[model samples]
Target: MSSRQDEVPTLTQPSEATRRPVIYDVTRIVTRALNAAPNGIDRVDFALARHFLARDNSARGALICTAIGPRLADPDLALETIEGVETLWREDGDAEADDVYRRVVEALGSKGFSGASPTRARKTPNLLYLERNWRAMRRWAPHLGRPLRQAPADAIYFNVTQFLVDRSWYMRWLATRPDVKPVFFVHDLLPIEAPEFFRAREALLHPRRVSNICRYGAGAVVGSQALARRLRQYATEKGRPELPICVARLPVSPSFLSPAEPPEAFGGVNYFVVCGTIEPRKNHLTLLNAWRALARDPAPPKLVIVGKRGWLNDAVVEMLERSVVLRPHVIEAGGLSTPGLRRLLAGARALLMPSFAEGFGLPVAEALAAGTPVVASDIEAFREVGGDAIDYIDPLDGLGWLQAVRDYATPNSPRRRAALERNTGTVAGAEEFFAKIDEFIVRL
Candidate 1:
């Protein structure tokens, strides 16, 4: 026998072997300032902040976080003090940041920190919001600037989105920094899909931003595969390379998953939940019409909407308020706590979210997890998240929605159970998601 015969080749998966363990390193560039619960992306920013602080010895890994404004406070310093994942407190800056943040802070009181002295106080929060856009407003501090100059370079990872304003600054920053592979989260291509929805300048600028994203971003994370596919389609149509995009399902807070006690006003009445900022995109006007058609009988299930009023539809809002069925049947919850939302969902017959478009429908999944049925539009993003679990309807068809509501309202239905069972396989935990994110980070 040859001496070479004694040596055996070792089989190994390099991608698996070289993959990094779960590590949290955020730049603490929060969306919609420190105070707002602006939109889906803003919500995600807060959720991620909580996740990093929740782990053991997490301070070593938690990069650039502060209890203050959008800037990263002392890196090695602040993480050392974070009490729990959910314990981070934030204070409102002066107005250049969106009104949502100020409203959220005043309405919610620093999320998880209520009655906690260091957090609850209006004057001195554990953190303060720095007015970055404040040029003439130097009375606030010496170190204030439009944007922080030096960012801590070495971190496990960073997250960002392609912004329309100050596009050139970020574009230059991203193109130069190959080491800091910003995980750009793709929300939607609404500007590409529905240009009429935006103003002339916005419509032109957004597609350009999307094109730049396809060209420059190192790694891309999308909320749903449908969105990923849509982005890829945009890239292909624009003659750009289809970069490898990761799909991370958004998670509902633990508060919403458990059996919840309903509010006293519910008084054992069945209802359907429709959540999102009321606007043309959300198709609330159409939903109100659908509910009207369904309520021809003495009393139909109430339609509970949980969001604040948003742009582009005054006539629709006026119509909803004046409807015969809507005055009492429509419960405009107007942004409740995660627990409050869960309690509402727990008793709901189903979640009705017949949106015209969505990057991913979050409330639909939340409803499914709560064992409540979903009635959403047949949009690709919803299908990606809810699978065949939801009762799909046309946003344009109020009559179809009426039928869907009737079907879902029926108890002990085999169709509903089947849909629920099918979606269970697609649901993923945070650790699983972190593992996937780690793989992408190591590749960079």
Candidate 2:
């Protein structure tokens, strides 16, 4: 690898359409577990890919698949490859089979599969699930052609999700490619800023990822201006003061825009919903404790937690599993469909987001777009996206959160009325978001 430079290249004039084919990196999506639903990053990846495919005739965009580990050089994934994957992703792929496999995996993992003996008998069900998905993908693999031997000199490499950042070898190899210009979309610097919230390995590796972007990327994109400023500071600190940065707001997906009836789970009762993974930085504990305090009310508002369990959140998980007072009021609606989540948000008294930190509060934006009230942390990112439309509070202030929740729960509450009045419509959509990106690419 070349020595780290203090300067990076600036965006040049627009190139001819044929010379500037945008190659989107799909290493993350291609390798995700088949049964898993799309998360924040996943949604961004799919949205960008879908937009490119929709405009294939007008724009020169292609999806390229790259492996993360040792054997990094792989052929470009064909257009049909993305189509097949999108089909499975959108439909959730053989629901019954996925459910069965998920149950088996969950049951085994809960039973200490991590420490289980390396015996074939113990691995049978796990292997069976993998084999089934493998065979299904194999049937579609033939339709997706092999990767290309080389890319064009002026091709642009766009990585929206920052996949494989820890594997510096692969990223460095791509960076050194004289023919392609690499651009990365940095979601956040949380791992570097608040290392305690993430695993030790990630805390160690994330700095390298930022360093790589500063050293080799043609430019960087951020979801909010707050993140853009953070990246600039990091670049200056690393002695790469010339790094180019762009700020583009992420779009609320169309699914979140549509109106729907509340799901039957609510049972005609008013509830507050909190979306996102159960993790330390999310501050689920604060909400849990507040709900515990409110349990004394004969008719306290229900709390709905929508997201799967994430790493480093054993305390929150324990509370969810064992707290008697929380049992009746809290609903763990993990694996909710996009439509289901939209309805839940639409019907909620308010969406409670007491996250200690955030790159971009998608759920908060989604809730506001759905005309649902929001009671969130007074973080910069939330302030950027939500402005004064949300009821902001200090993430650590449990009493403040309880009061906000209570105000929203009361019928004809002034806070709730104000939030509803401020709901003009959906803020932004995929088209507008991608248009900004496309313009940025053109300028590059």
Best by lDDT: 2
lDDT of 1 by residue, 1-444 (tens): 121211122324434413332223344332233322335655565555445444444322333322332233333332333222122222122221323223322322222212312111121222322343122123223322222224435333344444442255435544444554445667788867887665567678877777776677555667776676677777767665446576667876454455655544445565677888877788888777877676675546666677766777686677655555454456554434454466567667778887888877777767777767787899888887777777788888888887776666666656556656665534556665555554555554
Q: Where does model 1 exceed 4 Å of error? A: 1-38, 50-73, 76-157, 163-166, 199-202, 236-242, 261-265, 410-426
The Cα local distance difference test for each model comes to 0.55, 0.68
Q: After the best TM-score superposition of candidate 1, give how far the Cα of residue 389 lies from its true spot, in angstroms.
A: 1.5
How well does candidate 1 match the true structure in TM-score terms? 0.71
Worst 10 residues of 2 by lDDT: 115-124
lDDT of 2 by residue, 105-125 (tens): 232223112222221111112
lDDT over C-alpha atoms for residue 118 of model 1: 17
